[model samples]
Target: MTVNSISFPHPVLGNGDDISDGSISPEISFQISDESIRVDVTSLQTGHPDFDRMIEAGEAVWHLRVQCPRTYMREDFFESGSNKTFHLEGVDFEGLVTIEVSLVTTTTLATYRPQGLHEDYGEEKFRLGRGEVVGIGPRYQFLIDKIYDPLKAPVSSIIRIEEGEDSEGPFTVALDTDLIMIHLSKSDYKEYAGITDRVPTVIHSALVLPVLADAIRQIEDYAESTLWAARLKYLLDIRDIDTEKPLQAAQEILFSPIARTFREVNMRLDKGDD
Candidate 1:
């Protein structure tokens, strides 16, 4: 039996003996916040009795795949579910995110992807019968350059930070608000994921400090010198960090000069110390 027709992903063929072309259009919902993203899949009707009963009765389980900028995370399956939600916690993902929600017979969760369902990769692939792909809300990117996509750029660089091997949840980065956010480069992501020689490599912040300074210099040249009459204030969202170190560093770098200059001008005005 030649199986044909598929609404999304693509049209394909299955086994000759199987002959059963089952499709489940489960309801997928999503909500995003500063901390984590929550996804719930309901309306679990697949026209298969055992499958339907298993889902409604909480026998069917689920796992989640959350795709991020430069990387992706594969999470464990929900313990049991009828209309349960799987939370992608401690996840620092912005922009368009694709999540594959799967319902499986066994407790083990399989890593699902669109290409895996292809005929060539079938046997070793994570079958699609148990899963559906849903996208997050529209992703807005603040490209640094006035025009041109970063993915199309000849070269690209990025700084990434995340929790260690034993941790869970999104990795938080404190920014000064003035810095522009570049969207994730899909080209770099693909290479990085492939573990190829030309793939993106994780580098230390210090390594990119020069590139950052140079970029800033270009902006300063374009905008001319930025002068402010009032004191410069830094608003930081204090998370899990040693505040004293950063505070001290800032004081030494900027405040020290201001303090010294103010004292010199004040002494000159007084003429003599009382």
Candidate 2:
């Protein structure tokens, strides 16, 4: 079977408000209400453990941002408010088609709002608060650029796939589950790809493979533990597979190490580390 669309399911970053991901909610757009642009999210009480606890606390702040395809950051913070509606009218939303979501903790919410301050975040001299950006799913160079450690985090910067459809919900990895490589059939690919018009043969081209492979290699170069080295090897093997099943193979390779680290390293969940 031919590979179609690809998805990057973001791993949960934190225990509470420190996590924010695009898969929680679909692409939310601004509704023109009189002189204001009204942004609304429909996904509620998703039962995702990471977000559910924070939503229960009533101290979480949601941030919305959109970026252009060509330019990594051709968008800005439009508005911010409670977990519901965001109103803004300053920047142009024309080229900024990709929407990203950030769920900041109570500590971050009180310190900084996501609007007007978008520019400040870029050049802020002092340190800023911590949180997670579940916004925008993973894209090319995503793992190479950064691989999140569920252990430590002040904030998370997620990937937005340019090739995937905005309506195709974010790839979800269960809090209790670890990403594993599955020899996906066309049916599985369809499930991941969702309903898209174009059939992409491969997500990681020849040029992209080496870069990703190199990144995974670097992780092993410095990994002190034998288990870590073995885990990293799985990742490297997946990268070189060069089959139509790149996404599936990579996820398993990516997730196996995570499962090992979390299960073996520490009782993060039991101790409430987020």
lDDT of 2 by residue, 20-103 (tens): 332343334455432444566444333345444555664444555544332344434422333455554423332123345555
**In candidate 2, which residue pairs get closer than 3 Å at backbone N, Cα or C atoms, i.e. clash?**
20-134, 21-134, 101-135, 136-159, 137-159, 180-252, 181-252
lDDT of 1 by residue, 1-274 (tens): 0122324442221222121333444566766565766677675444545444555655455444445432344344453444657776634543334444444544222443323243544555343443342211121111112222333421222223222332333223222222322222444434334442321222212222333333333332322111110001111111122224543433332224345545655675697632
RMSD of 1: 20.2
Clashing pairs in 1: 90-169, 90-170, 91-170
Q: Would you estimate the TM-scores of all the predictions?
A: 0.31, 0.27
Cα RMSD (Å) between model 2 and the true structure?
21.8
**Candidate 2, residue 40: lDDT:** 65
- Judge candidate 2 at residue 257 and give its lDDT: 37
